[model samples]
Target: MSSQSSKQMALVAFMQAGSTSVYAGSWRHPAADLRFLEAGYYADLGRLLELGCFDLMFFDDRLAMPGIYGDSVAEAVRTGARPIKLDLSSVLGVLAGATSRIGLGATYSTTYYAPFHVARTFGTLDHLSRGRAAWNVVTSVNDSEAQNFGADIHLGPEERYDRADDFLQAVTGLWDSWEDDAFILDREGGVFADPSKVHELRYSGTHFNVRGPLTVPRTPQGRPVVMQAGSSGRGRDFAARWAELIFTGDPGLEVARAHYADQKKRIAELGRDPQSVKMCPMAYVVVGESEAQAQEREGVFLNDLVDPMASLTLLSELMNYDFSAHGLDDVVTDELIASTTGIRGLVQNLRSHIGGTVRIRDLAGHRATLLQGPRFVGTPKQVADQMEEWFTSDACDGFTLAATHFPGAFDDVVRMVVPELQRRGLFRKEYTGNTLRDHLGLTRPEPSKPSERGDDV
Candidate 1:
């Protein structure tokens, strides 16, 4: 447990606000509750994440239901399969008031929200949390969500990424609008502002044209930690440029390592420091005194409110196809899966386990996809061992903890697993830094370079 052994890391709890029910439908779990929208639930989670010696708690958000059930949205709503989705800013603001230091991160889709709205919401959050905030940037990739937004069809993958590039440019450009000292509290002369210090970002991009001097001043972290979670080819490029933390849903270590290396290389190629962007993978780490006990606990958790058929129905809608048409235990292929069917990214990764060892029903175990990420179940020591192995081998920068249920499941991780990790010196036992960026080891970005245009000398 020496500093010389290997580089240790940070942890962020992956919360979906309420009962995330990672499997599919664990809303029925005796311990699981659907009251995250009730406010108090997330306030408790915020405090719990900070108590665990964790750096932050990030709420993962998605715009629409999954695609495999069919083209219609009735299945997810009627079955109460991921029935409710909450507003990120509203929930995070509540959590901010509950915890003093733990960072709060939330997903905001670039493809849907306007840049000015994105700028104001997160900018305010960074101030409210005193710089302990991160923004998870995403592109809406589903038809149900598009329909909700008044679109006839979803944007093509490349177009979505393209729009995302323009969107982030406008948003970040807006974020840098005011220098830290733009607002002066000088009341003696009745002059409270310095107009010269504030500049506008007149950004005209492929999909957007925005002229902005953001209303709010600079945030606590300079700019809230810019985070990205996409892992596709386009995703990597976006993360390379803007993200300080890259949260992923990768399935295996080999693939994860490749992604890590490729991203770091890309960061350097973009003339940015490789260490600035920390790559983290999402995991459902179920720990116990012993491996057997952990597995038993996992089984119990899974048994409480799981319905494989409902999961299949939900999964189909997410991937955008009728996956229930296929047997729950059938082995699927790239040819077989789609975002409308089952997440292609997941089915592709789970493809290896399909032949004999991994059954489709096992994949469908609560309808079979492991939420949007992977799972790691074992004893506390064993989980620590796996974490250390992954860290040393460069599989990821660290881990993001996602619970199958709310407060209770997260509490278990904080109690049993966190201490074990601290004992191993794989994680810090106390808050070493005040700001979320400091804890995450990111430097404050420099203000944008002044423009040199046709009008400028």
Candidate 2:
């Protein structure tokens, strides 16, 4: 494991194959590119992040559009609020062909797809990308996503995590079926592979029963890197057991520090090296030549660009509840918290942020216009300074940069902030390794023997 003093901070570009990335109103920005369906759009962005020496470029995905608000998709379609989304797996192929060194990752839900399908797709991707592949594992949250998969409603958190645990075990087991030395191309000897080296995975679990081995061979990095972004208690526990990289969001520096420390402790308690698991918080940055200019840009995003109704619609979808009927000044009460089938952690965090009671209007603005996570809006030097403070203070191993505008938001960080970070000796100026595991300084896990396979479940 690398020591904190010697470790260079890692950076990942948060992206989505949609009209906008994370900022709800970004699609309307004059500089934002709306041709998301074109492969060339992603190819250009992938190369830019690689030029910046980022560890990875991750794409956040959802199976369905935001239609939970008022049980209608009208607001989402009208505002273009995450209504147009492309498949992440397909986008990964374009990125792989475009960049040589940067890690390419995409989200795939455990709840919607079969374990065998997920294992094979990512395994093939790792080989195609020459080991620069990562999988962001997630359990589908919204009811619309559940309906898309023929389920009437999304599973409860406890049931969802239980199924996810079994799903991962089956997937990893299949990945380990073929040893690294299983292939032996002895064409003259009339031999294609060593049958003895390839083993069948007879995995039987509560949620999945997958038989035999995955058709895909051992990839360049042995397997693709496993990334998770669960923030609930069950989510954190799942991450402790399986995730090599974890993503989270916190409103303040102190809260981020506490969450970081807690997650590290949990990983340590699970008998794993805390340093082996990197915890990254989402950071929204707006950089300019001067602090004043950056503030002005942020003001424009908040006041002029952001649409309050669109923001509320997005929040409603995320929380799995409808807030359209509530009055703007209505205070969230204890009964509402207890009755919500939505994300309890998110509600609790919002409650704490607003002193035990939250107004519907405030919550809407907080989630929509303002940055929901740790934010740094200033000159390049100031942005670097805040990142350095968080990095050195153990608040996070690094940050996942969320864009407020398409290439412009990323352009500022790569062209301006990255150079400053490199000058300060906090970030890398060039690529050190080819594989995603190598870039993150993680060891390739050894294939589990048949006798040791079932124990993970």
Candidate 3:
């Protein structure tokens, strides 16, 4: 990493293709636009975040709708809890057309999709965006998502990561198949490309078997920047080996610092530079002209906008455990915790936050407002102060700002908080480079040689 005084923060906007943000109640905010189904909505968002000089804007996705709660999707749809999940590839195309600088990213599960398909899709996206594409790698969390892919059960954590490890190898191999200078485009000589310059992937792994080169040409950035948000040990290991941008959801400064150190150490142990992998924790910032005004803005969302049942439904979906079987006041039993196949890190964090026996209601309440990460509510300068402290304290490389509402929440940050950060010399006043790697201070990856390739291929 650069010295603390000179290291500028890498800002990312956390986005969703559905009705609300990660905060389930955000759609209920009067200021939030309800036209999320339209491509124009995301296009506007893309342009706005680009204006703010955000390094990247990525969409979080789930393969299936929330239905684990009482084994029904009725309550989720009725409460407007992410019932409209649009395919991100189309949305990302709109965003690529709308913005010129900011990076575009979307989630795709390694478990559900074929590696060749992912390599082609993101490679094409990188070309479309002129090297501004990123891919957030995820192993689908729940049986609901598994069933959506026609599987009877979700893989356990170990198995999921194991498959993901191979999945990444195959994808990267296919991406590396075409040398940067392979395309000749020489119609005069009738030689469109050079054969020796292009090679076959022949990637054969435990989870994937890719026969040859990807359909897409070499991308501008060599490959799309790899983003991962895995808090579990196996997940972290996978991230350490592959991820260039690591997203985290830490509740406070101390916890975030520890995670940062651990991840960096893991990366270093894997023979990679720790600074090459940027660590960004999610933060929900409610900025206003005054601290009181910001607090009021936050209060409305936490106290009024959120619906209890909607939160419970989300909690069930995320944890992969049906909370409906237990009463609101029921203790979060050890058995219940052990049975959770979803985000186990979230359950542990909740236990730490409670500092005692956790109840179903407590988890519901936590999920209702902002699932994880710290909430910063104050004047623009005050929020910047908090952000600066975290950045300089080895807590994170920067932040992935979560919006309480769409467009408007981003508008507030771009109009208010960004200026403060720029004034403080903590963030970029303008984008210094074109590609996503350039914005994030990452180097373009070189095409892999056959000798350097994994044995699975």
TM-score per prediction, in order, is 0.91, 0.96, 0.97
Error of 2 at 321 (Å): 1.0
Which of candidates 2 and 3 is the stronger one according to TM-score?
A: 3
Query: Runs in model 2 with CA error above 4 Å?
Result: 1-5, 453-457
Per-candidate Cα lDDT values, in order, are 0.74, 0.85, 0.89
Question: CA shift at 73, candidate 1, in angstroms?
Answer: 3.5
Which 10-residue window of candidate 1 scores lowest in summed lDDT? 448-457
Q: Any idea what lDDT model 1 has?
A: 0.74
- Name the candidate that leads on lDDT: 3
| Candidate 2 pairs with clashing backbones | none
Query: Which candidate, 1 or 3, would have the higher TM-score against the true structure?
Result: 3
* lDDT head-to-head 2 vs 3, winner: 3
TM-score of 2: 0.96
Candidate 1 C-alpha lDDT tens digits along 1-457: 2333546687888777544555555565567766766888788778888898788788777777654365655666665667567888899889888988898899898878999999899999999888898888878656777778898777776788889988988888787777777778788987677876677778888988877778888888888988887666677888898889988776677767877899899999999999878888887787777899889877775665566656766555545567656775666554565334223555544554334555457656624435345567798777777777787888888888777767677888889888888887788889878889888888888767546111111
| Regions more than 4 Å wrong, model 3 | 1-4, 451-457
Q: Cα lDDT of model 3 overall? A: 0.89
Per-residue error for 291 in candidate 2, Å, reads 1.1
* Tens-place lDDT digits, model 3, residues 144-215: 899998898899999999999999999998898878888788999999888776777777789787776788
